[model samples]
Target: MGVEWVKKSFLVILMMLLAFTMSACGNTSKAVQKTEDGKVIVDFWYALGGNLGEAVTQMVDEFNASQDKVHVNAVYQGSYEESLTQLRQLAGTSNAPAVVQVFEVGTKYMIESGYIEPMQTFIDKDKFDLSQLEENILSYYKVDGKLYSMPFNTSNAIMVYNKDMFKQAGLDPENPPRTFSEVSAAAKKIRSHFGTNVHGFSVVTHGWFTEQMIANQGGLYVDNNNGRSGEPTATSINGEEGQRWFKWLHEMKQDGTLGDYGRAWDDHRAAFLGETVAMYLDSTASLAGTVTNAEFEVGTAFLPTADGMDPQGVIVGGASIWMMTDIPKETQNAAWEFIKFTAKPEVQAKWAANTGYFPITKAAYDQDVLKDRYNEYPQFLTAVQQLQNTSVTPATQGALIGVFPEAREKVVNAVESIHGGADPIEAINKAAEEINAELENYKRVNQK
Candidate 1:
């Protein structure tokens, strides 16, 4: 062949090879297996890393080794938001994974997408006993008397404080603040005792904290019973509860009792670890890392409510496992098997002990491993007790708005505005109205 023909031929061959590789690689969560062992392949996409990822990898390896009929390929896709984005793009495609983990805020959107098989389908088809699951944890994902996904890793917000700082401030560490007013008082005391370098408390201007505060005060987040009775027509954040929360935060800031960390979750965490702040409200999911990094004795307590308002309950936070629809029966069955395995008390306990995410089921606590772990580190029990004490009210079940993530961002902006000395009532009202408009669009699109 001539030189020109030879070069063209090489280019053609290279293109073909690249195509083959791309086809074999499949989606972000799936890759072709090397072995032809007659075992079905099940791809699982998860959104955890670090120690939590290691714990999940162990579970997957154990599950794969336990069965010859199925093989699970676990893929770590960045954050929960990234995983959900990939899921939305891959749905109904041949390259889609068999299972995906989506964050709590994405729940309504996932349901509206109509791409996933309701976990209740498999549960009913297989007669899976759900009694072992924690009712409070399960309540958040259930809608219209059905669960669309499996509760894999559930958590809630709590107060994390430095007990040593408490003692130095002459405040009882065991009696951590139970309400927003108490938090303010404690913060003032700690700041006075520790001086200007150390703040009394710190909080990120995140929307989840806003949601949790409203729920704890037995207030609704959105209309239609926090979206349990029907689709939410509007959000309820501009009401009495929102005013109280933002006003308290403003007052705290004015008095140097609370540190402004803006929207960086880690900044507040670092504040806690560096002892820049004596206490802060954060996720129960943060227990393991907080305990490990803090030099002083770290303490845990239920997240504080507004003054004179006892905590009715806090909503479940964290993500859950969702199975995609229209996949092969064999692959779907295998995925369900892996999911069911993870739900087992043994696996749940292992996950809880390792990652500090609350186990989804009550039975997990009955496991000897978890019991021993809890006994060894009693801080874990605080979240467990909080979940147990939560009432099964619609508000506590969490708001299921289709535009939840957007609504949260709007709330965050409102918080920032309030921190900058804007009127709390005006900021909250503007956010609520804007979120209501978004909800209207969502309703039109979803036909709800």
Candidate 2:
């Protein structure tokens, strides 16, 4: 609870907008910058708050402390949406930072912006080995099959359970729930034994939770050609599998087991830590923060599934470092240096250790320090194991279309319908229709 803990440097940043259709910032698309003071002042916009901001700053401080030529000043911009808005105001303005942290969902926008440098060329010229990063992690930043952003700390959802609750329910905590059937069974047992004192399971479906469920069911949330492939003019989200996931949520809600809508990952954790929710599934990054303060012994498991299907690949989460194209070459180069430096193994392993995000570099995962982490906290290994075993399935990778935030909100509005007595299938079908219409509109407006 110390101030340092508040700023501890490597926390996963979540900018939950509740509703996705916020007015986006006016395009900061291509501007130029001039240099001053012989010290290139590289503007760095970070989305992390508290100690996580401190962690990013810790590295920024190191970069600054290491040399006098480039002065990287770190700016904390509230959340991803807020940072994008700030960038909008600073766009074409001299105050714009050279580097801004962008969430994965914004990848398509940044690539189309043409305002940032492509990372592939940067690596080839700088002799930065792109091969050092695992194939699974590297796919998150690519556009048109070329790298644009450097993969930083990455994570995926992991199943979390209250061990005491599981134990009271006569469930084996060590084994945990591997598939959806087991999850249903476990929930029933917990409810049967602990009554309403404990929960069988709960998942806050905002942000990428819906997509994660799609991936969990071995289904794709969006097609490769964006939403175009799923249907000529619709989405495939209300398919049998997607409905199954929603049905599970609906059942949980009806059984007095599920939690609320609009409860973000952090809010759910706050609830989980408060002992209100017995089981939760969320980002791997949640472990370190929650474990540090958890009063009960928490258990971790691979995200569950149904019947014969394996746990589908998990989608990548966590922010990436974005370079503004308008910044002076010196500042841009300096920003690249910092990005490349952070991608190094030592720093990555340290980041992984500090935050639950899996290291982007294999070296970090193989590092002695990180290897010891698994030994120290077996529960922490779930995501690491899951991500290692994972693949870049279209479902897990996510959809790429403009007005992404808007589309995500439409999905939520469908989710909200379930509480209002609407059928899950009907609600999802309505959501896909809305998404397809918006998708076409976005494509039309942002046409190249």
Candidate 3:
């Protein structure tokens, strides 16, 4: 009887132990997802929405179908700011994505965050030929002589005008404004011809336009070579170039030729489409949509500079793909494979054609897809020419400050104030002072 009881107890104990072991193994497998064939799974978190999001998902599907080694799981995480905020909370945890798309203004913050692996590391390991990419676009992502991220969707500010309206106003349709004074004059003429029913010009009261305007005139947004050389101690937006920009808008407002569309991009674009505004400043990314939706003929031109100054060119405004550091090396490699796939000429061509962003890869221009797109929408070529003509300088390479997003808000506030009859100099000076204080605080916290 005692022997039978001992045997029953031993069997029960052994079954419980086996059950626990099996459960542990199942939990470990759940930590990192994999395909049935044991391919590495990479998590890609992107911030693009609407058609752009669909495009990203399509690319991921194509990549998955093309390869058997890696599977990419694309996740949309909201807007640029929201995505970054989520990353801040999830970083250094297993819940973090292997790759993320960060905007241009987030460059300094991402570099200092210590949460990402420099793209140069992978480039060196794989002997990647960066020369195949566009040099001007690449310059924006290179910092401290190293490439921090891979440029994906790139764009520059351009002037989109109503060619029909220009003719009606007795202005040269072929000769759009090339200087601030020219734009002001043209705006007045446009308003005069159309009367109070339409405004001559409008730009969304966003700081990005202000940045591009300042940079186009060879002006620095901050000291220390726009923070490329070292940390920026102060903002230079109150300088001569910035003052010219603010003053230009002020004069137009006084003349009642400028449309106040607030800060919403949609509102400004709607105004242009609705024929409430004759000309407007917008990103190249809007070219395709605006051209497709507009009833009147659309003309694209380079952003205007000050009266006598030659245009230095506009800064690239878009996002780049970043690889995270906390993930396993295998997953990181998988992320790299996806990144390389995104840069392929065929893939980039498709992306560019579907969206208005410039393909970072130079070879994409040679692809039939992109060529067809350019042929279909000739206005798209203006953005390409503008970027190619841009002089690679400290100003044009764009500013690098950890507080860039915040600083942009300050600039927008200054613009609103100036339009509301505030003194341009005083409004600009106030913004600069606020940005300087923020920069000092950022430096203090980030100091090693």
* Best prediction by TM-score: 3
Native-to-model Cα distance after best TM-score fit, residue 195 in candidate 3, in Å: 0.7
Q: Rank the candidates by TM-score, best first.
A: 3, 1, 2
Residue 374 lDDT (model 1): 87
User: Tens-digit lDDT track for model 1 on 332-364?
Assistant: 787899999999888899889888888876778
TM-score of each: 0.91, 0.87, 0.93
Estimate, for each residue in 364-396, the C-alpha lDDT of model 2 and write its tens digit: 877888878777877777787787777676666
Deviation in Å, model 3, residue 435 alpha carbon:
0.4
TM-score of 1: 0.91
Q: How close is candidate 2 to the true structure, as a TM-score?
A: 0.87
Q: Is candidate 1 or candidate 2 better by lDDT?
A: 1
What lDDT is obtained when candidate 1 is compared to the true structure? 0.86
Q: Write the per-residue lDDT of candidate 3 for residues 322-381, one digit (tens) a residue.
A: 998877777888889999999999999999999999999989999999999999999999
By lDDT, highest first, what's the ranking? 3, 1, 2
lDDT of each: 0.86, 0.74, 0.92
